[model samples]
Target: MASEFISSDIVSILLFMSPGFLTIALVGKLYGIAIEMEQFEKTVWSLIASIPIGIMFVYLNEINSIDSFLNCFLVHPLRSTFEIIVFSLILALLVSLIIQHKYLENLSMKLIHNKDDGFQTDRTVWDRFMQKNIGKAAIVETHNSVYKGWLSANSSRKEKREIVLDSPVIVYVHENGNTEDFPYGKQIILFGEDIKSITILEED
Candidate 1:
């Protein structure tokens, strides 16, 4: 009988406690994109953090009492659910903030941002320039050729190795500074594998 009771308690903890901690991390996201971490690692860390917080929540609420003792599922099932959710949310937000500031910066390693502005992100000089010059004309210089076009702002992802251009006019720059647009379609895609530099052209 004692072994059965202990097994039931263990099952209850596994079923409720595991998902309870996961809910906390999801709530902490505030409907934003979740951080790029391994799902297994995230869950493990969340559960480890949540255990003590869950205990504190139970102690504070005093939900466990003789009244609910007959309910072998948990000391106070309904109230415990509420406690888990609230505590998980609080801990989730706290841990997310710690990881954002203490562990990783905005997106890239070589980026600068204004702390006062929530959306002010400044990465490398080239990236900042591209962001500011979106829809404007620019020249993408590669190892063997150049492509001129309006910079597509959405071309770059944090770790992507390629970029996109709209209304592209492929051209080659001569040593004497002469340029002639090549016969090609309006759209051009360039890979960082061969790109040497990006120059924002003054002409429209």
Candidate 2:
């Protein structure tokens, strides 16, 4: 009977943490954040977040305290759980927007004395360049050829490093110093290993 009671308590604690996990996932998607953490670490962080969320919900709903909320949750599980779920969704979305817009970061920069202009939010140079110049006309230079087309998509992985170009025309220079252009109607996928340099063309 004691073992069964402990198991039930464990289950209840896990169930209470579900909203936190859901909020984390929602925030990641909406904010475009890459949550790089192990499952155990994520669970611990979620549990920490869940406690505050529950407290906030209790206060907002005019509940007496955490004890009252827990009692209501136990007595009316379905309705209370649904309300928590809805509140979590809204909270997650708001948090995601805050991260995405970098409002806090900007505020900090203004308040703090930081004059270094080298700071960038993107993880990599490729990401920064692509964010500003995606879908523009570009020239891709390979070892033996040059490809001119509109830049489509690029992979985020540094190891893979693949890029796609739309309606590319490959220019090959022969041994005779004659250049021949072969226009491909379909898109071309180029590996980073084969690419020598990429230049984004400006608006005419």
Candidate 3:
């Protein structure tokens, strides 16, 4: 059954149109998810698998004399089959983006700013967040102080219990808890025990 399906015209058209087949690769690149060779593979495979699943949505054509006319018209490069393949893959990509990016991103406050965690399985999920956000703005609050700075640390879960901060700025909070930045510090090493909480700030 699998071999028969693989030999079908649907798969043939998809394979023949290989040049523009995975437009979802471009989409993932736009979203910054298709970086490096490993992630590129993931993005392409996700879309490749998605294309056939997407075809299920297209509703198979009914048998009739018009089928011959349609087939004749589709013999050229820009065939009706190509159109079906492209549009179905795109719709599937959209749904895939929602599920993999938006839904999973916010599912457990798992990523910074509730955004999709980009291509990285380098460490634990939270650790991966820090790895990707290096050299970006961050706000760290400890037991005795608040800080804002460009994150200079490259921390992984394997490191166990510390995060390094470089070029840190002190943030002073008033009685009502409104904070003002008083940028200060050369470098600070924060032990996990001392950290009350840390927020990776927005990058402009």
Candidate 4:
């Protein structure tokens, strides 16, 4: 009787542990996909953030069914499967939400604030630069200026292109700031370190 009781307790512990483990694994997988798609190099960081939350969920569930928890393992395999599926779905949703929020936060910083230009919210400067130069390519005349060029960043040779501003570059210009024209015979480059503000100028 003693041996049987010990075996049953062990089985119950395994059953309880299984659901949580499944939840973590499923969430982790979804997070991994999000990381790849978003190119966010913080998988380990996200996983670390989630651990405490997972533990809290497990503790809460255990507290609700302290007595017959172990018996849940032996009820039926289908029931166990169903429970795990539901838990995994919830975990996936949570992870996706976390990932999305982080992505938006990072994206927000890349936006330029130019309220006087009639933009209500901060707009991504790099995106606007691209839009402005869509038909006529703009060359980085200097760290602070862009000029019309025959070849835009898209068509330029890798060697001729500025490594910085690889993504859309956001420019922030102060209200009533001076807009400078792109000088001739100079390449434009917005080094990651040199970005102070973004300004849109009308061609004179």
Candidate 5:
């Protein structure tokens, strides 16, 4: 009897704890966060986060007349699970936005009379600078070539950073120190490994 009860409890936990786990996983992926938690820690955190979601589910169900249809066996489990999954996804997206943009965090800090504008982000200095300055005209230099273009996209990773330039021009330097620019009418991708320097031109 006790064994059967234990098995049922385990099944219930596994079935109902998906929202919390899904939320955490989605948040990490969306915001590019590295989550390193033990199984026990994951379980505890999932349980904690799942509580509010579960309460919201119950409140919505109570307010709506869908409970009558949800009581049916075919509709109850599957539809309820789908609704919870959707709610979890929305919550994860909102959480990711809050963390990535730091809108809520900065507002809270200001409300609390903190001096800093916002919390320190978990991104590299290059990533932070480029994110704000992308779409600006810049000069990128490599071992063999120099490119002038508008910055299009930049990778956020610390290693093997890559960037794309729109409407690039290749600047060739002769041995006599004279420079010539040849317009390359398409986008060009440059790898961080070969890049020597990048200079962002000031706005006119």
Candidate 6:
């Protein structure tokens, strides 16, 4: 009789703990996406928020299976616990996906807007220029007007600082109260006024 009681108690504990364990596993999977601890920590907090749901599942499964020994045949407590855990995992995953998607969307919007009024440049101009021409490339020319090598703006920062343009490409142009293309790696000499524009010539 004592052995039977021990078995039942073990089964009961397993049945109750499964849902919370499943929740932690699901959250851990999402945290593996990026190593941002802030985001991962927030996700763990969200998992904790679902503990009440897990407790409810555990209570329901235990109560439903308490009566008969043959209850294990028709209504398996462990199986019911797993089912509830799976449901909670799905819900938590969906919520995490939605939050991640929103964050990406907001970041994309900020990149496109480029809200520095001094430049007055918008996304449409940026898109049009990039479509017609490849991304900003630093063209180095010798003082004798000879073409040197081309360097892409996306290149490493160390590479960018090493670039030098000859006299022709290194002219000083005024903003003239008009929006200009904000090219990458182009040096802007902002006098007393703030930097208002940038333009990069198409690489031939």
In terms of TM-score, which candidate is strongest? 2
TM-score of each: 0.53, 0.60, 0.39, 0.34, 0.55, 0.31
Q: Whole-model Cα lDDT per candidate? A: 0.65, 0.78, 0.61, 0.48, 0.79, 0.47
**Model 1 per-residue lDDT tens digits across residues 56-105:** 66467553843222243355678666666676677667656756674554
> Which residue pairs in model 6 clash with each other?
181-198
- At residue 189, candidate 1 shows an lDDT of 80
For model 3, how does the per-residue alpha-carbon lDDT over 88-171 read when each residue is reduced to its tens digit?
456546646775667856654464444465633444765766767877777888899988777777556566667777888788
Candidate 1 has a TM-score of 0.53
TM-score of 2: 0.60
**Candidate 4's residue-wise lDDT over 1-204, tens digit each?**
989878777765555455544554565677665232232424444445445443554464463553355544445557546755675568666756776679755554444343555545533445556545553433344465443343244322222223233223223445789654433344334443443443333445
lDDT of 2 by residue, 73-179 (tens): 78888887788888778878887888778886677555443447555442466765775688999999988779999989988735477889999998778999998
Candidate 2 backbone overlaps, count = 0
What is the lDDT ranking, best to worst?
Answer: 5, 2, 1, 3, 4, 6
lDDT of 5 by residue, 1-204 (tens): 989766655655565577899888988998888777889988898887787776677677673433332343234777778888898888889888888798976775455444265555446767766877899999999999899999999899445699999999998889999989899989999998899999999999
Ranked by lDDT, the better of candidates 3 and 5 is 5
lDDT of 4 at 198: 35
TM-score of 3: 0.39
lDDT of model 5 at residue 68? 34
List runs of model 3 lying over 4 Å from the truth.
1-21, 37-44, 47-49, 52-76, 81-89, 92-101, 108-122, 125-164, 167-204
Q: What is the Cα-based lDDT of residue 97 in candidate 5?
A: 88
List clashing residue pairs in candidate 1.
168-186
lDDT of 6 by residue, 1-204 (tens): 989877876765554444555655565677455333455655565456456655565465554544342354247757754667677677657656765778756765566566664444234543444334334443333333222123232222122222222222343235785433323343421221222333455656
